[model samples]
Target: MIKGINKMLTKSKLEFLVGLGIIILPLQGLAAAAPTEMTKDDWLGKLKAVAPSVICQGFFEDASLKKRMEELKIDNDKCISLIPASFDKCQTQYYSGLPATMNKDSAAKWGHTIGECIGTDFATKYLVSNPQASTSSSSDQTTSSSTPSSTSPSTPSTSPSTPSTSPSTPSTSPSSPISSSTPATSSDSQSTDISRDQWLAQLKTLAPAMICQGFFGDPSLKKKLEDRSIDNTKCVNLIPASFEKCQNELYSNLPTTLNSDSANTWGHKIGECIGTDFAKKYLLPTATPATSTSSQ
Candidate 1:
């Protein structure tokens, strides 16, 4: 009886150990099958969830992404499971905490980005918000889009009995005027864009306005101005907040020479160098002693 009881107890203990081992063994290997983990897409579905968007934009231009873009090409679209990840990056970067005023400098950058991937309308609207967008051709902001209709209707046929040969008709009128109008308008527009870029660069730099004008206003200046007949009043009405900030930024770039009784002295020197009225009009109002920045 004693032997039978000991044998039964031993077997029961062994069975319990075996069962515990079975449970504990799998727990120790929690990551052994991690290779089968679902991807960002598999978990989030077709559109990436918030996590992926942040990873794309926050990590865009990261060296790894650039390498991935080049090496994978079309395949790159699928490599990370986020299709066309670069665009995800762009949207994130563009809308992220942006400055309200799209000044000449800001507009150029946004325009370049827009040109590469987005529709033109957003880019033009962004530029219009900047004071520097005034290079004579912002008027070209006009554009319209068309989408294919979901349903199509059959075309009606003309009467079959219509005479095959009609009476002699005068030759189609020349469209030379239409053709002529486009080239001049196109050339003028191009000129204005070129000018806007030049002006943006100069205003962004330490270059004095006269020096900048000289550089941009050459025969090429026409090309730099974005619009020739910019309506300042209209511009203010369009984007008053940005316009106000951009105007402040424009003056911010002016020379430190404006900070002195020496402004009068500096103006004389600048007039001698550039032979222009810029210094007189630009510097006189803002001139003050060097230490007076806070008082203003």
Candidate 2:
């Protein structure tokens, strides 16, 4: 009878141990599955490394823009240089505003914001026709100035001829009265108006593509998305919605009139806003588990 009781006790103890092991194994698995959270510094370091690629990729995605950059001899190194101190401050402020700890998802979401900021900065600084024009203008001015100096000796001989022609020149000028300043002013106004319109239109078309490319081009960001099982196609599909949200938030506040400078400024801001929105929606992990449990 004592032997029988001993056997029953041992069997009961074994069953209890087995059940405990079962419970502990799942708990261990859950702990392992939880994402490791990073501090602000870690996140900032990662973003700084990743943002330049994203910014350059987005800014040069347009074939013409890429070609123009090549012509200007602007390379990725120059692209990195365009990241301003203000942008560093922006990133610091952004991460400081977030929770003390960030998971991969949160890090990636904010990474997009950093990319947007840098890209906008790059576009604002380098995307204009001005840089190329200025370069060419300098050379032209140098050549034209030399020509005038070379021709100055002939001016004395022509002085007598000038008096005779000057009378006719003034008469013809008064009759037609072409105000050089007026035509230039009119031409400038039309050019500015057209450029502003064209810029706004191009921005509308290109902003989405830029945001999408920037988000995916960064190696770290792409890995984060991959870890979440979010593919490029999924994110691409989300762009229209993301872009529309940003546009509605930003576009209304645009000044009634936009010149080249103002357009560049606002365009940068708009791109930044779009990137923030896109990341918030698709990059950040959803609280689906909590919602599902709550519903149940």
Candidate 3:
């Protein structure tokens, strides 16, 4: 009777193990065969659902990319939540490999690459129209200056353009009212809205091209400009008379570098050089009125 009971227990355990395997094996196969590609809606849906760690292998570790994502209103928690979907979508569309098979470091790199693609897409789709939304914190000083304060009502009535509490009012006196200043100049437009740091950053980003074109005299860039029917001299000139005009022409025609998609990749260094040249030749001269007057 004891032998019979022991045999019966062993048989039951074997049956249970076989049943468990039957249930799990198909689910494993289904997971392995899961689709990779996603539609536009699918991309967004994944971005909205995935965890941030999956988004960028611990997203906060990369400060610059993390800040960029946050600027897109993808906060840390939201970013984490969106990572799984975004990673899957990215793997389907942009990256074509088995992310599951990748090791820890490789997976992190893969995640970051996918994150950047998603970030670029986010910028193109949402940021173009709502530029202010992303940079609100950095631009707070400018926003505050533009905002109507408690004294603004009384101040605007007295001086429509100038803020009532401006320190420059002491120098203006009764003779030269700030509002009666020279006609709005293109130079003013160039300087306004953007801060010194902002302009300098922009200049640095564009300096490489400016140095190549204006200083080094890049022949290929010149030929490209000529081919476009653009006045090559305008782009290459740093002299005051033609400098601004040339820069304007180059800036407007920048998109033609190699079509809009490839332009940024090929044109970034050139653009940086142009920005540097503009700062040295144009921005510097106009920015220092006192020094120029003293020299004269």
Candidate 4:
């Protein structure tokens, strides 16, 4: 009876071990299958591949725009060709401030923001009402070719008037603005005339106020800052200094005139730079020390 009980006990222990192994094998497989974290370079690589096609599709998918392009004889290929240049311009603005490493969720959000920037840049440059004139000119050419020779002289006269009117329209519009906003134009001209040193000094004085307002006023970002224990005072004190670094990096190719649109663009860029510096300095998770294990 003792021998039989020993055999049964040994068999039960073997079955328990086998069952535990079966459960653990899948868990191990699952752990191995888990995704590795992506670095900023990896995300940027993926963005370059994806952003152009996405932006082009958005423009081409618009029924009215597509129809207009068809009428204009503008090849969709032309739009595709412009994407590389647009993406290059926008990539630095959006991606330069991102952390080196990101988890899946954060990487996705960053990608979405960059995609929007690229789309805006591409649309601003390529999608214009001016291209419609090409279609009109082509129609004129076909009409002249089909008409009698006596009528051709009239077409030339009408074409000359069209070009003359085009130049006048732009001249009158600009003159009206210049006449109405004489003071504003003078101030703009004065700003253009300032030396670079004076401009930098002015920017430095303005940086603190702009940075503080942008940082604390943003609802989503404010929560993130609060979580990091970064309040208004700390932000004002610490972040304004980052503007100098950002200026050195981004302002080397500054436009001659810093108009309202350009100012807004640079403001966003500098703000991003400051935010990036702050994150690198403070927001990264601290590494925990590993516990020592004694060998048996």
Which of candidates 1 and 3 reaches a greater TM-score?
A: 3
Clashes of 3: 24
Q: Provide TM-scores for the models.
A: 0.15, 0.34, 0.23, 0.32
Which lDDT tens digits does candidate 3 get at residues 118-194?
43332232222243443443243223323222111101111111211222332123222222222211122112132
* lDDT (C-alpha) at residue 254 in model 4: 65
| RMSD versus native structure for model 3 | 31.6
Per-residue lDDT of model 2, residues 160-220, tens digit only: 1111222233211211111211121112222232223333444554344344444444555
Count of steric clashes across candidates, in order? 17, 0, 24, 0
What local lDDT score does residue 28 receive in model 3, on the 0 to 100 scale? 17
True-structure lDDT of candidate 3: 0.29
Q: State the C-alpha lDDT per candidate.
A: 0.23, 0.37, 0.29, 0.38
Per-residue lDDT of candidate 1, residues 1-296 (tens digit) = 33332233222111111111111111111112112222221211111211122212212222332332343231222222331233233334454543453333332343233222221121222211232332222222111101111000000000000110111111000112111212211121112112223222322221222222222223332232223321223211222222224435443543532211222232233223221222221223342321332121
Off by over 4 Å in 2: 1-191, 194-201, 287-296
Q: In candidate 3, how many Å is residue 183 off?
A: 54
Top candidate by TM-score? 2
What TM-score number comes out for model 3?
0.23
Summing lDDT over every window of 10 consecutive residues in candidate 1, give the lowest-scoring window.
150-159
lDDT of 4 by residue, 56-86 (tens): 3333443434554565465544444445554
